[model samples]
Target: MKKTIIVLLTQLVLGLACADTIQLETGSFVTITLPSGWSANLNTSRSNEKVYWINLISPEKNENAGKIALDRLKHGWAATEEKFIEHMSASIERLSASLKEQPVSLNELKTDNAIILYQVLVWEKIVSMITGAGLAEYKGVGVIHIRYNSGHTAMITVPIKTLDNSNELNEILNIAQNMQISMPLSENKEEESAQSSIQITQNEHGTVIGNPDISRVSLLLPSKNYKATPGALAIGRGDPGYFIGRDMVANVIMSGWFSPIYKFKYKTARDLWKKDTPKQAKNLEYLKIKEWDVMVHELEIPIKTQNTLQVTLRANLLEDGTWIDLRLSSMGIASQRADMRKALIDYINTLQVNVAEARGFHLKYTKQGVIINAPAETPGSLFIKTKSLLLQKRKTHIKTEFFLFQDSGEDIKVIAWLRPASDYHYANVKTLWDETRATLSGEGFTVIGDTDCQKTRNWDVMLYDLKTGDKRTRNVNMRASCVSGGIWVDVHFTTVDQRDSSFLRSKLLAYLKNFKVSDSHVE
Candidate 1:
């Protein structure tokens, strides 16, 4: 079985390199650039039964069929239109319990030798789902299951999976990229609600969106100020990273993107931001933003024959102890710089929690902050926002989402995430301070100054001033001690430029001295 799977994988890889177009085994051709080979593995149990799994199983074609075509998705599809839906439903459930019973659409394409039945089901997979046989990550999965037989021939099964992070945006892009039916696609798709009728639901996964069912973090924009990023997706795994709702209008654009910390992809949000910053914009300055201290860079790129300027801002925030790097991009010309900057600041300031409307969590942050212990209401219930004051202790409590912190009030406005000790790994205070500065410098933020002192034998204090703005200075204070088991209590503070650091210095020590870690478990 292993050998057989290897042979098939090798063939697929070769076919991908040799065949620009995909010729389905059923004798139909579809056009797409060559996809790399598939990943295959064989699993055998104690019994004689063996299962072979192939991943990315895209490249294939038959001697008769030139390449993969919608016309070839005609095997089991024709016989089991109803049964196919049942299977798709079951498969969706397997992907994530949060996914709704999304609507399924079926279309048929007739070719010379065979009739292809393609089932296009739009649903969300908040939690990523992986499958055997070369099918990879699927989030807002468009489970395209094709099955049909030419009456005299045996039935065929061709399943394709796509991972989409946003629903409406992705659905529209998917239709443009994949809807190749001879019939007018808009006519059939209109029978169902447009992608604009989007809905969001929370589950074990962090966030999810529907109307094509892909998982994403969403935020509401000021009606006239901004809109969802406008563009078209180009085939395959279109783009990576889950963007909430990025809006780009005319010359000015506001967008937000995030990277998960648990992936161990980066040390902190700052590190994540720095790593993502383009190489062209080096020597950027770190400044104090409304929510968190951010590193800002300005760059100019040529779009078509015209020149466009873009300013990128990056910051670090912790959600439920999960480290997340957040980014905001301003695009247009330097002439609109001041307008876009003010608008960007206003937009971030207005971000509030509106989950009911499928909006994102925008918490407010300031120099004077609180150390909150967000207790859970239920024993094992998962909470994204930090709120509960009562202690929640459970033997099996595991955090399923990032730790979210907002300003104190009913209308929670998020500014920053105070990452727990678990997210940061530092041997000592000096190492933490020095490494942080190195990282900031690498990300283009100039380390204005650094201070380290051992006031007492009990603990050591460290400070770094990353002041990029002419009006303010963003300072971070770290007090590390062996008592907390090599733990560092990092307090972020901002002060008006040229003001004596005396006030902020005292505030930092006070915040660190008076803070405590909560139950230390995810609610």
Candidate 2:
């Protein structure tokens, strides 16, 4: 299906960024220069043409100050600074109407360099009422607008908390100066329709491999070939998949491979693709794709039928140790086997990857915590909670950051608590756990076997997988660690339903594989 057109635009969003800067595209009017460790996400799309919301992200681990959105508006170029500022004030007012809090103060700027007209707004914040006193902890909200030619305007904003100052907004604006507008990507619907063409011609010839010259990843098709069924990229939803073809009649197994893994370099392409394969596969041989060395595998049996199919896959290693694997199958029909094999062989021989040089992945800023290369996650719904709380007292402080993501109809949670190691007088993790175990549960928590306590990235660490609570309460799967005198962090997931224990436990373990605390996030 033409399922991937709009979706493909953002697939390469975080890949291959270079030279101390990351690029961000709104898929609308602007693409901006994002400094390293900084990320901006599209917040809301408005029917007002080019008007939209882009969130400014904080690099801090658990800065849940709520969303700070920059309003972008496109209009006719302002004849004077006065006109620009007036336009900006009106835009802010229209946006502010939907907000719980209203703008209380607005100011215009007179600058030495007058290429851009500017305005900044300070807003009254809504307070959370407690017993009798309101939690007036919010400092206020600050917004700065920059109006430029081409009828373009952008703003940087934040809900300033008492602990954070106005300088936070200033620092953000200074960073904004480095941003350059990115040209809009073409939104031709034809690109979407073209993806479905791979499946159209079926019953007589082999699959029509996409053209090598015009395609993103190059390969050739037979002169008279059938089109395969529709498939999405296995790694992401609605992304283009490798065309699957069998006997020109009906193909059972269809698949593709995607990698952001400059991380798992030495692993064979079979090693990567096998993870998503429906049936167990066995490594078969190693061969050469032109000058590149490739590994091969044969799927044991992908689909069950008397009419059997033989599927063999080959992958080539790129210069940087990355891999691109091609999977082709031969049907049980004797005549079709040779035709499919010959077509696939010719296609494989001509395969060429024309992607950007691989770079390590980027970090995504979720509302509660930052994700280290996690894919599109719709967090904080009824099924999840992206709640983050920062607590402080006379001498103790703790930041409890929660990221709850559900997969396979089960809730998976990561609750991270960050505290200064000095709270425990810089005690070894074993001692701290021995002491804190009593505080978390009346029954006491169990320490998983051979708890790992190793220093990594300047954090002296300790880890214990703990479990406690009875059938009446949720189960806790937790890890506790200390970074010498700097901080102690605990990450864990609590199962919501008692019946989900085993399934949740296994999923939690798999989920933990992607969980990481960025060293920059450590206080």
Candidate 3:
């Protein structure tokens, strides 16, 4: 079977010198050489089993009835050689029937590296689905399936008029035969030289944006045809690590935001402003690439003076407490959309994120001048600000909260409250703890006894044994505090059962051990 496939493909094979590689948004890659005057566009925004499709347009546009396409198989549909041929044949037969053409023959050829299946359909006048207009000639469909040894398979389909047009068919088949497939390479594996790797720290693999002093990092971008630089945006930029991308002529501008993942409260980019701009905000795709979940959205943001700018926002969500947000904006009209999309995809393909260095657990609140470190795998949770008159002379209060998830139901909540000495005057750290305890007691919270108090060089600590007096769900809660001259850090731990509470308490202490508060306050 393999011998027949090899002989058939060897007979129709053509050679090309140069090749272009395309990285599919679905975490696969394809490399194929194109014939001169032929253009290729990869559609990475498809919401289907086919991860993406590469559209190949021939130079003889007037003569060719349809463009050749290579679609990457996904969802375990073409995982094996048997499944690859099974799905490809099924698709070809279904498509032929829909076009009202009889399936002439389905031939299988096997090469040393891949399994090939080609089918020729009966010629028929193809009607345009959009305009319902008849085509100039009767179109014959050519469906080819190429499954490489690397477990990557792409189904190639093109339009053919007759068997006599072997030149075009051979060219299309040659592209399929000579195509190369591989898995996406990681930044650590791909970049090894000192020139390619940015080494501010041993773990840092990519480039740093905004202020490197704060330990902000993101993917390393290409600097040949594109220019990258740190910049301030209208949206208050320094902390989020804002950077700009400019083309050779500066016709297209790209703004990127890279920061700790905890800063983004929303699940997806569309959720950021979908409620406000329902009509203008459109989610293009959500792609899962290795350890990252990328959410892409297209927005028509209105600028009061500039009318509107076409914006493409890509939110790259990394599991290790970091995210990369990129916005590609252009003032070009709708007609130039195709060109813009091609440029966007091509640029995105070049990005290689340094996952090892980018996954950081340290978070700094520049405004409050506070920095806190969490468990390596855990990211800080969202917080809702609230005001309280706990202190007698309370004029200003700021709180930072983090809910670390240990397991499915186990959670450790940590809240840090910053108050300058100018606003509240407490005789000692014990007085601050007394005020906080009184506030909780007034709010219908019962304080369990056996509480321990310790005086450390950094702060006066008060640890609560257990606080539980509610008709709500059954839960075990332990709250503690480390109060300094002007800084107060509250550590709250909760679990479903008392047995689990002990295990969670150790995790909470580990976080508190690493936690450090600087002498600087919000004063």
In model 2, residue pairs whose N, Cα or C atoms come closer than 3 Å (at least 3 residues apart or on different chains), thus clashing, are: 198-228, 199-227, 199-228, 206-226
Candidate 2's error at 260, in angstroms?
7.2
TM-score list, all predictions: 0.30, 0.26, 0.31
Better of 2 and 3 by lDDT: 3
Q: What lDDT does candidate 1 reach at residue 8?
A: 17
Give the count of colliding residue pairs in each prediction. Answer: 43, 4, 2
In candidate 3, the residue pairs with backbone N, CA or C atoms under 3 Å apart (3 or more residues apart, or in different chains) clash, namely 5-109, 5-110
The candidate that achieves the highest lDDT relative to the unseen native structure: 3
Q: What digit string (tens of lDDT, one per residue) describes model 2 on residues 71-111?
A: 22221122345666665556556445423234535655433
TM-score of 3: 0.31
**Which parts of model 2 have CA positions greater than 4 angstroms off?**
1-254, 259-286, 291-311, 316-326, 335-338, 357-523
lDDT of 1 by residue, 1-523 (tens): 0111111110012333222222111111222221233222222211111111222232242111111222212111123345544544454453332223434454545444444344433433222211222112222233334332322112122232332323322222222233222111112233112222233334443333322211122333333434333221111011122233444442343433222233334454456555555556734767665545567676654333344556666655443222234456666655666665565555455543232321121122112322332323311111223221111111112421222221111111122223333555666667767776787679877766547555433445565556543333333334333223222233333322223455555644554443343333222
For model 2, what is the C-alpha lDDT against the true structure?
Answer: 0.38
Question: Residue 82 error for model 2, in Å?
Answer: 61
